[model samples]
Target: MISIENEGKVKHNKSVATKLTPIEYKEITKLVEAGIYLNSSDFVREAIRDKLKAIKVVKIRDVDYEIAKKEVLGYYRSHLEAYISEVAEDLELDLELVIKITNELKKERRLDEV
Candidate 1:
C-alpha cells in the first residue's frame, strides 16, 4: 500500500492520451480498484519513478556485465590472484580455508564491477 497525499482520491492526469499497452492499462486499473494506488496516474508515476530509480542506481546501459563477469571470475582480474598464487606457492599448508573466504569476497565485490 502507498501513502498518497489523498488516499481515497482519483486525481486525473492532464495527458493527451499517453498510449499505454492494454495489459499495462488493465494492470493499473486493477491496482487502483484494489486500493494499491490513489489512482491510475499515481500508479503510472510510481512505476516510472521506480524504474528510473533502478536505472540511476545501476546504469545498466553503459555496463558490460559479461565482460566484467569474465574479468571477475578470472584469476588475474583482481588482487585475488596474489592470494591464490601465495597458496599455490605454499601448497604444504591446507588452502581450503582460504578458498572459502575467497568465495565470500567474490559475492561482495562482484557488484562493484557492475
Candidate 2:
C-alpha cells in the first residue's frame, strides 16, 4: 500500500477578499442554511482542499504508473501464472478478477502471447 505524505498545513491569514454577486451570495447562503457548514468560506475551503487532494493523489499515482507498469510487464513476461498470483497477492485482489484482468490485458495486446 502506497502512503502519501500530506505536507499540507493550514495557515492563519485573515485578509478580506472579493465579494460575490447576489446569485452567488444566495447560493452560499443556501449552503450555510443547509446546515452543512458554518459559512461560505468553510464551504469553499473544504471544496478546494478536497479537489486539490484528489488532483494530488492522481498526480502522485501518475508519477509511479510507468515504473509500476514496467515491473508488472516484467513479471508478465517471465511467468504468467506467478505474475497473476503476485498481482493478486500484492493488491489483495480476487483470483478470478485478476485472471480476468490478465486475460483482458492479453486481449488488448498489452501483454504478449505466451
Candidate 3:
C-alpha cells in the first residue's frame, strides 16, 4: 500500500507496479532527495494529472476561441468594446487575448458585419 498527502489529507491506496528506465528511475529518486516530490508514485500521479489538465484546457480554449470569434463578428462594428468585454467575462479569459484575437479576425477580413 502507498499513501499520498493531498490537500492535508492522507490517501492510502494499493500500489501498481511500473517499470522505469534507469535514467528515469534516477531522475525520480533525485527529485525525491531534493524534496520536490514525496515519492515516485506521487510524482508520477501528479505529472499525469497536470498533463490531463493541460489537455483539457487546450480543448476548452479552442471552443472558447471559436465562440468568441463568432460573438466578435456579430457585434464587432456596432459594439466592439462591449462585445469584447462580454466575451472576455463570459469565457473567463484574459481581456487582452480576446482583444488580440478580435483584431486578428478583423484584419483577416473574417469579421465583416452582415
Q: Best by TM-score, which number?
A: 3
lDDT of each residue in 1-114, candidate 1, tens digit only: 334358787655455358889998898899999999999878878878899888732122232444433433453344444654354233322344435434655677642222
Give lDDT for model 2.
0.65
Instruction: Show the lowest summed lDDT stretch of 10 residues, model 3.
Output: 56-65
By lDDT rank, best first, the candidates go: 3, 2, 1
Candidates 1 and 3 compared: the better one by lDDT is: 3
Computed on alpha carbons, the lDDT of every model, listed in order, comes to 0.55, 0.65, 0.72
Model 3, 1-114: lDDT tens digits are: 657696887777765678899999999999999999999888999988899888733222444667766655666555545666676666656677788877888789876533
RMSD of each candidate relative to the true structure: 14.9, 10.8, 8.8
- Model 1 residue pairs with clashes: none
Lowest lDDT sum, 10 consecutive residues, model 2, at 56-65
Shift of residue 95 alpha carbon in model 3, Å: 20
TM-score of 2: 0.40
